[model samples]
Target chain A: MTRQELFEQIKIKQSFLCVGLDTDLNKIPSHLQKVADPIFEFNKQIIDQTADFAVAYKPNIAFYEALGPKGWESLQKTLDYIPKNIFSIADAKRGDIGNTSGLYAKAFFETMDFDSITVAPYMGIDSVSPFLSYENKWVILLALTSNEGSLDFQFSELKNGKPVYQEVLEKSSKWGNPDNMMYVVGATRGEKIGEVRKIVPEHFFLVPGVGAQGGSLEEVAKYGMNSRCGLLVNSSRGIIYAGKGTDFGTEARKEAKKLQGEMEVLLNQYCY
Target chain B: MTRQELFEQIKIKQSFLCVGLDTDLNKIPSHLQKVADPIFEFNKQIIDQTADFAVAYKPNIAFYEALGPKGWESLQKTLDYIPKNIFSIADAKRGDIGNTSGLYAKAFFETMDFDSITVAPYMGIDSVSPFLSYENKWVILLALTSNEGSLDFQFSELKNGKPVYQEVLEKSSKWGNPDNMMYVVGATRGEKIGEVRKIVPEHFFLVPGVGAQGGSLEEVAKYGMNSRCGLLVNSSRGIIYAGKGTDFGTEARKEAKKLQGEMEVLLNQYCY
Candidate 1:
């Protein structure tokens, strides 16, 4: 899906929240464990309960992958369960050779039906171009991440006088336009989001690390929000596994509503 | 698996070849298509025929993930089909937040049961350290990729007067010792392999871009080979889908043998 369509969905739903489906079998309540696919069951409930409050569902590939074959089946089911208007992301973080990446594009876009897939840009353009080739598909490339270790290489000053992450943002921008591409600038790096904004103000930013990761949503919105409300703030543990009991779905909805409410305030402040 | 164990496997097999199980459904013969899972079937046969000759089997995750839930199922079966002694890699190129990355560690190492997995170091230490937490498991960080676009950022000079690829190799080396870490230095970048070896002489290197990618194995071996035969030369399409007819397995085996034969000679010259 194009970025504009995603923006419209967010506006219509009055939410910019992307509920992360990092569902873990071990973390789910034991009551649901008896279900054939507990991961899918959990995802289904989460989607059903929180669909109205969330504009996107980001299913982390690793969680489903941990269950082996059964986990994958659950992931597919979860993707199918998500509403058509909501953006679905296979947070796979995949990138490889050109031919191999093309096959990956087919896997996520053509076969399983996800609107977007997160890609690691370390392999350079060839690995990312394959994903970009799909019409209307999005490539969320890693820029400045939230982790403390991000200071190691990403912030390292390059010979060209720019930091490594900035260089990646500048170079990768040429591969695809803002409509087909996005950058993952972690919300935890609130101070630096302004620096990131200067690089690509038009592209949407998939901002994670809010809530449970200690990133302030207020700070991220203040510094990172553009005219288009260019942010998809994700909160996995904070939203999905909020209550952890029989009323988990209700609690999830409440948590999503809280985030959406905050997002609405941000959107209004940014004149969206 | 530990680097010592991987080296022993190479010596026992008298080859440093790592057959890339990049099984593409479209590339497999029609006869295999009738199987329950064509990708898994092809991988099983390839593993069986080449297990005695190859030191490792690198399954690029894009290939498996492209098939969706079924592809992941095939990946699990292929992992099971590989001999216990040979090194197995889930080339997923994953790197994310610390907590999420910990789950990724569990997915590949604890759940899916791979000896190693490819990672993109662009996210820096937090993105990579979670993978290193797994004892004896390897994190094959992308160093120098073999693609035209690799020149975009990887070769851009860093403020430390080193290229970004060199900076990644140098910094990431501090996170894990050579025994638990490796870097992917593309085989096509033979000239720079010598430079990479200078920085990461102890860690093993997973070199792709051989065979179909037009990378010279001899040049790679000459410059990149370390004292322990520290190179996992991967040939994906050129070896796995050598022929498209019913004798695909036989053809695959023949193609793998040709690479192994060359690897055997390289091993002798370097190790002895």
Candidate 2:
């Protein structure tokens, strides 16, 4: 999806929350196990309940991959279940050799029907450029992550003096315009969001690590938000797995609504 | 698998080639189209034909993901098709929020049964750390890429005066020891291989962009090889899709044998 379309969705929905479908078989309510595909069953319910509250649904590819063939079937079914208006992301951080990368582009953008897919830019331009070739498709590159280990390399001072993450943000910006390229900047690093914004101020960011990871939505909006409400704040475990019982879907909707309500306020304050 | 196990495989085969299963449904021969899952059929044939010539089989995740439900099924079948003696990799470059990333770890290492996965470390420690938590599973972080666009950010001079890719290598070294972590250093960036080695000499490198991208195998081995044969040179289109006819598998085997033969000589020259 183009940046403008995403912005429009955010404006229309009065929300910028992107619900993450990190579905786990074991964690899903046992009552749904009898269904043909428990993972898809869980996702369908969550999407049904939270569709009104979220502007996007980001499915981490790993979760679907774990269930083997059955898990994958559920993931496809879940994608089919999502409302068309909401942006869909295959959160698969993929990058590789050029020909190989081209095939990957065909997979995520042409075949899977996702609006966007998370990408790792470490392989440089070729690895990411293939994804950008598709019109209206987005490539969410990894920038500054939100984990404690982020200190291990992201913040490390390079010989040129800038942190490694800053270098990625600056150089990778040239590959595609803000319309086709977004970034994965963790909400946990709220203090550094301002710095990230300066690097690619126009691009959207898939911000994870909120809710259960302890990152504050207020901080992310204050520092990272753009005029377009260019932030898809994701909350996985705290939402979908909010309850272990039969009301898991309802509980997930409550969690999503709470975040969406806050996001609406944030949008009003910053999305001018 | 640990670095020791990977090295042993390389030694036993007398080669360090990692056959890239960047399988595309459209590219498979007409004979294979009759199968329920053509991508898997092609991968199985390639694996069976070339297993003796390769130490590892790296399946780029994009190919499988593009097909949606069917693509994922093929990926699983392909993974299972590979012999246990050969290292298997879900070339899914994944890195995300911590809790979600932990689930991704379970998907690739625990569920799908891959020995390692390609990761984009742009998210910092939290995104990568979860993948590293798996015992004997390796995280191949993006380091220096080989595409023309790589010059945009990967080579950009950081504020600290070093290039961003160099800093990524130096900082991410601490996340996992050489045993658990590897780096993706493109073969196209031949000149910089020596510089990368200076930063993380012990870690194995998953090098792509060799055959089709015009990267020289001799140059990569000369500058990048360490005492442990620290490289898993990959070739995708130039090998697997060498021909588009019924002899595709035969052609793929021939291409793999050529690369493996070169790799065997390199291993001997480097005395690994």
Candidate 3:
């Protein structure tokens, strides 16, 4: 999808919600446990139910990777099942040496067909540039992640008086423009998102801490929104695991609808 | 494998050489192309020829992941084919939030049976801690990589007068003991390996860039060697793809033997 296409999806849906399909077999509803490919079934339903509200689906790759080849198959099926208009984000934080990274780009962008992939910036230019070569495909680099561990290295003070995340944003932003690049700015720190916004205002921010991580959606919109509605606020456990019964998809839809309704208000209030 | 076991393997072989199974289907000898599973067949040949000289095997995951599920199956077969005594390192630079990291741990350590997995430390402590939970398993964190891009963020000066890699070494060293933790200290810059060794004295360093990437084996041994001969010097293309003809395995063995010969001389000169 192009930058304009992504923004158009947001406008058409009245939301920039990116529902994370962090599917774990142990966490799925009991009724679905006996199915042939339970993980895919669960995700198929989640996509079916929440497609109306969500503009994107971010599948945390680790969840699928845990189950080995079978898990990868399930992931492929789920990707094929998602509505084409809804953007796909492979939340696989992968980076390596140049040649190796090119292979990874082949894996996610060519083989599996993700519109975007989350990449770690620690390896620098070559590790990330391979993913940017594909037109309409995106590279979501990690900036200020919501995890507590983000402080260990990413938030450290540099001699230049800027935090390491700022250094990451400043340099990495030059590697790819807003059209092909995005930043994973955690919503756990709304003000920090504002700080990141100031660093790279044009690139889309894949905000991951909006729901279960206690990031207020309102604060994210107020501080991080751009004229393009440059944010894809992600909610994983909060929406997918909304209920324990067979009616889990309905419960998930309810939670997604609530967020979408709020996002509609935020889009009108902030981006407009 | 435990630290003592790995060290014992190093002593037994008199070569801390690690064979990197960066098996690319397109690059394999044309004869293997007719095989049922050429990737695995190629890797099996490489491992068979190199095992006597190498103390460890590091399979670069991206090469396999690029092939999708079939590639994943080949990787599992390759792991199963490796000699039981040799250490296995999944060169999968994976790390995520805590819960997701745990799943990655399950993927590489539990499901796949790798003795260790390379993890990118940009996410901080939580992303790393999960991999350390498995007893007798290792987390080889990226400290100083060999690529030109390593200069991008890794070598930047921090406010405390230390480079970012040093900060990673200092903070991350406390998270896991030397027994369960190692560092990927690239050998592309020989002197940089020495600097990393000083910050992280006890833990083993999986040193890449010895051959195809152009770092001297002698320089790596001189600067990066420790009390336990604490270096697993990796040579990927130089050893594995040494010959493009039908006698590729024999040619690979010749290259590995040359490195092992040098390593034996280094072991006697530097340590015992």
Candidate 4:
């Protein structure tokens, strides 16, 4: 999807919420395991319930890959089930050489048909450029991640006082504009969100680490928001696994609705 | 496979050669496409031919993943076919949060039964720790990549004058001991291999860009080699697609044998 289209969706829904389908068979309700493909079934219900509130759905590829061929089948099913109007992201942190990355671009963009795929920037331009080849498709590069490991190298000060991620932001911005590129800035680094905004004010930021990871949504909106509401705050476990019982779908909707309601206010205050 | 076992395999084979199974449908011979599963069939033939000369088989995961479900099935078959003595690497540069990285660890190590999976170090400790959780399995973190993009952020000088890749080597060494951890130092960065050796001398280095990518095996062996012949120099397109005609297998084996012959000399000169 185009940046304008994505921004439009955020405006129309009044929520830049992206529900992460980190669907694990063991975590889903045990009753659903009786089905041939429980992960898909669980995701279908979760997507169905949360679709209205979420402007996007990101299927964490690791969850699907763990199950092998069956997992991939479930992933394809989940991708197909997501509403076309809503943006879909293959949260597959994939990057390789130019040729190999092109194949990945094809896997997520052409074959699987995700609007975006998360890419790691460690390999640099060639590894990421292939994903940017597609029109309207997005490459959500890992800028400042939420994990504890983020401190090990991400925050390393370069020779010019630029943090490694800032260097990543600066170098990568030349490869693609805000239209086709987004950065994954962890909401756990809430205070630093402003730092990221200062670098790429126009580009969208896919902010993970909200409820379960202890990132405050209000802080993210306050610091990260732009004129186009340039933020996609993702809540995976917090929303999908809101309840383990049969009413899990309803419970998930409740959580998503709660976030959406807050996002609606933020959208009105910032973008709208 | 255990570190000792890997060393033993290298000694027995007289080569630390790793054949990269970057199988693509478009790249393989047309005659093979007539088969039910050309990618697997191609891999099976390559493995059968080069199994004696090579100590490891590294399947570049993106190639298979691009084909969707059928590609995954082909990958499973290929994995099952590889001899137990030969180390298997899923070149799936994957990394995420702790939980998600755990799932990825399961995907490559448990479900797929790969001995190692290439990991991107942008996320830090939690993203890498899960891969280290498995006994005997390896996490070959991206240290200094072979591609031109490696110059982008990997070579950034930190506050202490340590290059970014050096920092990656220093910090990640704590996550996994030499037994379970490895670093991918691209063959293209042949001169820098000695610098990497100084940092983590005992750990194995999965060196790519050897043949097709213009990396000198002699330079890699000279600088990167350790007491255990700690290098799995990979040659993908050069060996696998050596011949597109009917004699593809024979040509591939010829290339493998040639590399193996050179590796044998290096082993004798260095370790023995």
Candidate 5:
């Protein structure tokens, strides 16, 4: 999706909520387990109910991959079911050498038709530059991830006094414009959102670590929002696994709506 | 495979050569295209020819993923065909949050039964630790890659005077022992191999960029080899796609045998 298109979705929906479809077969509603593909069935319901509130759907690829080829099929079905207007993210943290990365870009962007894919920036420019070649597809590079391991290498101090994540934000920004590039900034660190904005203010931030990960929507919007509503606060388990029963889909919609209601207020306060 | 089993394979074959199965459908000989599942057919022939010389078979996952579900089926057949004694590396640079990383571990290790998988270390400890839980499996972490982009972040200087890759080596070595952990050190920079050996002297290094990427096998063995002949020098295009003809399998075997011959001499000089 284009930058203007994404901004329009956020404005129209009154939320920058990107619902994470990190679907796990064991975690889905028990009643759906008997269906041909439980994960896809669960996702189909969730998307059907919550599409009104969510601006995007980010499928965590690892969950599908664990089930082997069957999992990939389920993912394809889920992707096909999601409305085109809602941005689709293949939250697969993939990057490799240039040629290999080209294949990955083909896998996620062309074959699967995802609007974007999360890419790890450790291998540098050639590893990431392939994804930027696709018009309207974004490469959401990993910056300050919410995981504890993010502290290991990403936050290491550079000689020039910038942390490695800052170096990533500064250097990688030159590779692609704001339209084709975004950064994955963990919402757990609200202040770091402001810190990341200082480096690249115009770029969107795909913020994970809200809800189940205990990040506040108010703090995230206060620090991370830009004029274009440059924050996609994601909630996976908190929203999708909210009440695993026959009415699981309805419960998920309720959870998404609650988050969206808050996001609407944040959008009015910060972006407007 | 255990570290001891790998070293034994190196000694038995008198070669530490790893053949990368980065099979690109477009690049393979046109004659093979007539066959059903040409990628797998090509890999089957190549594996049949070169299995005698190669200690490990590393399939670049992106190449298969680009083809979608059918490609994954080909990969499954190829994996099942590889000799049990020979180590298999899924050259899939995958890492995520802890729970998600566990699914990835199940995908590659438990489900696919790959002996090892290459993981990018940018996410830190939790993202890496899940892959270490499997017995006799390996987590070949990316240290120095053989791409131009390697210069971007892998070489970032830390305040303590060590490079970012060194910090990765020092910190990550604590997460898993040399038995279960190896590092992907690009053969492009021969001198960096020596520098890496200084930090973790006993660990095995999966060295890529030898033939196709202009890296010298002689220099890699000189500085990188340790008591166990600690290196798996990979040559993908150089060996697999040596000649695009009906006789491509024979040509691939010749290339692999030539590398294995050089590796035998290196073993005599360095390990024995």
Candidate 6:
């Protein structure tokens, strides 16, 4: 989807939320395990319950991959089931040399048809350029990730006195404009979000550390929000694993609704 | 497989050559396309013809994944068909948060039963620690890659006056001993391989870019070889796409034999 198109979805839904389907079979309700495709069934219900509050659904590819080919079948089904208006993200975190990266672009963009795939920037421009070549498909490059490991390499000081992550933002942001690219800026450090925003002021930031990871929604909005409501705050574990019972979808919806509520208030106030 | 087991295979085969199974359906011979599982059939024939010359087979995951679940099924078949003595590598280049990285480790290690998986180091310690926890399995972290994009960040000068890739070598080498960890030091720059070897003298280095990407095998052996033959030089297109006819496997075997022949001499000389 184009940047304008994605912003329109945010405007129409009054939510910039991207529900993460990091669905693990071990974590889902036991009763659903007997189903033909439990992972798909779980994701279908999650989308059904949370679709109203979310503009996108981010499926971390590792979850389904753990189950092998059968898992990929379920993932394809889940992608097919999502509403057309809602953007889909394959959080695959894939990057390689140019030719191999092209095949990955084909995998996510042509074969399974995701709107975007998260890319690791370690391989440099060739690894990223293949994904960016596709029109309307986004390359969400890993900048400052939400995990504790982000501090290890992302913060390494360059000779110019900027951290490695900032250098990633500066160089990679030029590879594609705001329309075809986005950055995964962790929400854990609100000040860091502001710092990243200063680097790529117009690009959409997929902030992933909001609910379960102890990142505050208020602070993310305060630091990161732009005129386009340029943020997709994700809450995976807290919402998807909200209730372990049969009515888990209801509980998941409740959690998503709460986040949507907070986002609504932020969109009105902080998003000038 | 343990480090000793891999080294023993290298000695037994008289080669440290790693055959990269970057099997693309589009690139395979026309005769194989009509088979029930063409990808697996092609791989089976290739393994049969070249197993004697290659000690390790590294399948680049993106090629199979581009074809979707059917691709993965073909991959499983290919993995199953390989000889037990040979080392198997899923060149998946995968890494995420701690929990998600654990799932990836499970996918490549337990679920699929790969001996090792190439992991990107951009996410750092926690992203790598999960893979290191697995006994006998290896995490070949990307240090300096062969592509032009390697220049983007891997060469960034850090506060300590060393390049980022060197820092990756220094910090991550301690994460796991030679038993479970290896670094992907590209053969494109022989001096860089020597630089990487200086930091992690004992850990194995999975060096790509030998033939097809224009890295000299002699230079790689000269710079990267350690006392234990700590190198797995990979060549995908040079060996796999060497022939495009019905006799492709025979042609591939000839290419593998040529590399193995060179490696035999190198092993006898430099690997003291």
Interface RMSD for model 2 amounts to 2.9
lDDT of 2 by residue, B1-272 (tens): 66777778888888888898878777789988997778888888888789988999998886777676677678878888889878887777777657667877887887778989888766677778888888888898888777776776677676667777777787789878998888989888677998999899898888888988789999999999999899989888898998889888899899998888888899889854
Q: Write the per-residue lDDT of candidate 2 for residues A166-236, one digit (tens) a residue.
A: 87888788878888888888887677988899878888888988998789999999998987777999988
Q: How well does each candidate superpose onto the true structure, as a TM-score? A: 0.95, 0.88, 0.99, 0.99, 0.99, 0.99
Task: Give candidate 6 regions above 4 Å deviation.
Answer: none
Model 5, range B165-264, lDDT digits (tens) per residue? 9999999999999999999999888898999999999999999999879999899999999988989999999998888899999999999999899999
List candidate 2 segments past 4 Å from native: A1-9, A157-162, A189-191, A198-201, A224-227, A269-272, B1-9, B159-161, B189-191
lDDT of 1 by residue, A1-272 (tens): 77878889988987889999989877898899998888888899999999999988999987777677687788888889999999888898888778878988998898888999999887788989999888888998888888887888888897778888888899899999898888889887677998898889898889989998889999998899898888898999999889888889999999999999999988999746
TM-score of 4: 0.99
Alpha carbon lDDT of residue A189, candidate 6?
Answer: 93
TM-score of chain A of 1: 0.98
Scored by CA lDDT, what does every candidate get?
0.86, 0.83, 0.94, 0.93, 0.94, 0.93
Clashing pairs in 1: A107-B66, A158-B159, A159-B158, A159-B159
Alpha carbon deviation, residue B201, candidate 4 (Å): 1.0
Prediction-by-prediction clash tally: 4, 22, 0, 0, 0, 0
**Which portions of model 3 miss their true places by more than 4 Å?**
none
Give lDDT: candidate 1, residue B9. Answer: 85
When sorted by DockQ, best at the front, the candidate numbers are 3, 5, 6, 4, 1, 2
Tell me the TM-score for chain B of model 2.
Answer: 0.97
* Model 6 accuracy (lDDT, Cα): 0.93
RMSD of each: 1.8, 3.1, 0.7, 1.0, 0.7, 0.8
lDDT per residue as tens, model 4, A1-272: 88888888888888999999999888999889898889999999998899899999999999999999999999999999999889999999999989999999999998889999999999999999999989999999999998888998999998888899999999999999999999999998767999999999899999999999999988899899999999999999999999998989999999999999999987787665
Interface C-alpha root-mean-square deviation, candidates in order:
1.4, 2.9, 0.6, 0.7, 0.6, 0.6
DockQ of 2: 0.54
Per model, the share of native interface contacts recovered reads 0.82, 0.74, 0.90, 0.89, 0.91, 0.86
Error of 2 at B250 (Å): 3.7
Give the clash count for model 4.
0
